[model samples]
Target: MLAAMRTFELSPADRFTFAQRAAVLSAAYADYFVPLWVNAQQMEAMDQIYDVDARRSVVAHAGREPIGMALLSLRGPRGWISAVGVIPAWRRRGAARAMLRRLLENAAQLGLDEVWLEVIEENAPAAALYRELGFSAARELLTWRYPADGDLLPIPRELLQPAPVERALAHFAAWHGQPPSWQREEPTLRHLAARSSAYELWMEDALAGYCVVGERPDAISILDIGLNPDFGPVKAGRTLLQALAHRFRGRAFTMINVPADDDLSRALAALRFTVTIRQWEMRLPIIAR
Candidate 1:
C-alpha cells in the first residue's frame, strides 16, 4: 500500500493577475457581515499602495487551480496580513494553515518585529486560528452605517472649522491612551493630508473635536474622527459627527474601523447609523532583538 500524497502548491501572487485575487477574496468574503467593498481595481490599488513584494503572498493550489490565498505587507518592523482566505470547498484541508504558516515564516525571514491583522468579530474560526498561531487581539473596532436618506437636523457650519494637517496630526498624537495602528506615524499623516476636507469642531467657543473625510466618486469615507478627552464624550462626539454629516448632506457616507467603545458609536446609533460589523486587531511579534 502506498501512502496518500497531499496535493497542493503555494506560490506568490502575480501582480498582473489580479482577477485571481479578486475571485478568491470575493468568494471567501461573500458572507462577510461588513464587506470591505473591494473590487478588482481596489485590490490592485491596495497592492500598489502597499508595494507588493515576493514575500507578500502565498497561494495554495491543487494541480493548477487556486484553492486558498494569503496576503501580507511590511509596515516597518510590523508585518500586516491583509486578506487571507480559502475557498469554502477547500476548508479544513490544510490550505489555510499552510498559507498562514508560510506567511509567518516569510515575516520572520524579513525581520519583522510583529505581525498584525484584523478579523471580523463574528468570525470564530478565523479568530481561533489566529490565536492558535500565536497572534493576540489588540483592540476592537466598529463599522457603522446609515441610510443615505435619514432625518438628520442641520448643524451650524460656524461650529466646524477647517483643520490644518499639522494641527490634526498633533491632536491625534496626543490622544489619551494607545491610539489605533492606523493612526500612527506615516499612515495617519498621509491620511489626513490626503483627505478632500478636514474639519475641527468647536463648542462654547472652544475646540472640541475633529474629523477628516476621504471623498470617493460615489461616497465619502469618514477616515478619522476624534474628540478631545476633556470635552466629555457625549457633547463633543455628538457635535462633531452631526457637523460632519451636515457638511456632506446628500452624499453617501461610511466610516471604517471606528472604536466600538467610542462615544461616536453612540452618537451615530442615535442618528440611525447601523452597526455594520465588528473587527478585531491582531498582532504577532517577529523580531526579538
Candidate 2:
C-alpha cells in the first residue's frame, strides 16, 4: 500500500531535514543545461532569507520512500519556485503539478503580487508546466564565460578603482531597460556587497562604468556591470572586461547569468565568451479578485 503525499511549510527549525530534501531534489533535477545543485552553505543562506511562512516543500511518498519534492522562496514581493523535481521512477504521477499548485497557493497567502522563475531553454516539460500555471515569457537570460589565460590589455590601470557601496547602489538604480522582476535590486546588491568586489572605471576623472565580480572556488563570476549607455557598447564593455581581467589576473571567470540580447552580451562574445546555456525568465502576475 502507498502512503498519501503531503504538502507542508518548512520552518527554520527544520533545517536538517530541509537540507537533506533540498540536496536530494537538486541531485535528481541536475541536467545538462539546468544545473540546480546547492551546497550546504548555500542552503543555509537560502533558509536565512527565504520566509518560512511563504516557502513550502511538497513531498510525494509511496510507502517509506520519498518520490518527489519542490521548494519555493519568497523574496520581498516576489515568490520564486525552484528545484521542482520527481525521481525518474516516480515521474508522470502528477507529483510536479501538485507541488506547483501548492506553491502558488502559498504564494498567494503570503501576499505576493507576483511570482517569477527560470527554466532552462531546453526544458520543455518544465516550461510547459509553468505556462499552464499562467507564467508568460518575460525574457531570455544567458550565461557567458571566458578562460583566464594571463592575457592583459594595455589600458592604463590607474583609471580603475574599487567601487564604493553607496555609489554602486546609485548606479544600479539608474540602470534602465531591464525587466522589473529581473532587476538586481536590494537583495542582489546586498549579496554583491558581501561576496563580491567592484571596480569603477574612470574616464577624465568621471565614472564611465562599474563592474562587480564574485569569486567562487571554481570561477570568478561577473555579478553585475553597467556602463554609460552613451559610451557605445563595444568600447564600454571592452574597458570593463579589461579592467576586470587586470584586477584578477590568471583567474578564470564565468558569468553565471546575463541578458541574452543585451549589448554587453555582444561585447563579451567579441572577447571570446562562449554561451554556456540559455534560460527563459517566466513571470506570473497575481490578478486581484
Winner by lDDT: 1
- Candidate 1 residues lying further than 4 Å off, grouped into runs, are 1-6, 14-16, 35-40, 50-54, 154-157, 162-167, 175-177, 181-195, 202-207, 216-218, 229-234, 266-272, 287-289
Instruction: Estimate, for each residue in 1-289, the C-alpha lDDT of model 2 and write its tens digit.
Output: 2324443232322433656666656766765355567776676665554433323545555544556666676677877775577766556777778777877877787788888788888889889998998999888888887776634554555456886665765776555335433334445556547667778887666677887777765468877777776666567778778777776777787775577777777778777778888888888987552
- Stretches of candidate 2 above 4 Å error? 1-16, 49-54, 57-66, 150-159, 180-184, 216-218, 230-234
Cα misplacement distance, residue 255 of candidate 1 (Å): 1.6
Pick out the ten consecutive residues of candidate 1 with the lowest summed lDDT: 176-185
Clashes within 3 Å, all models in order: 3, 0
What are the RMSDs of all candidates, in order? 4.2, 3.8
> Cα deviation in Å at residue 2, candidate 2?
9.3
- Candidate 1 residue 285 Cα shift, in angstroms, is 3.2
For residues 1-289, write the lDDT of model 1, one tens digit per residue. Answer: 1113357888887632677777777776676664544678867866755544534688877666667788887667777787888766777777888899999998888887888888988889989999999988988887777656767755755467887765765677654334554433346446347544678988777777877777766577776676787887666777777777787776677887766676777777777778777889888877642
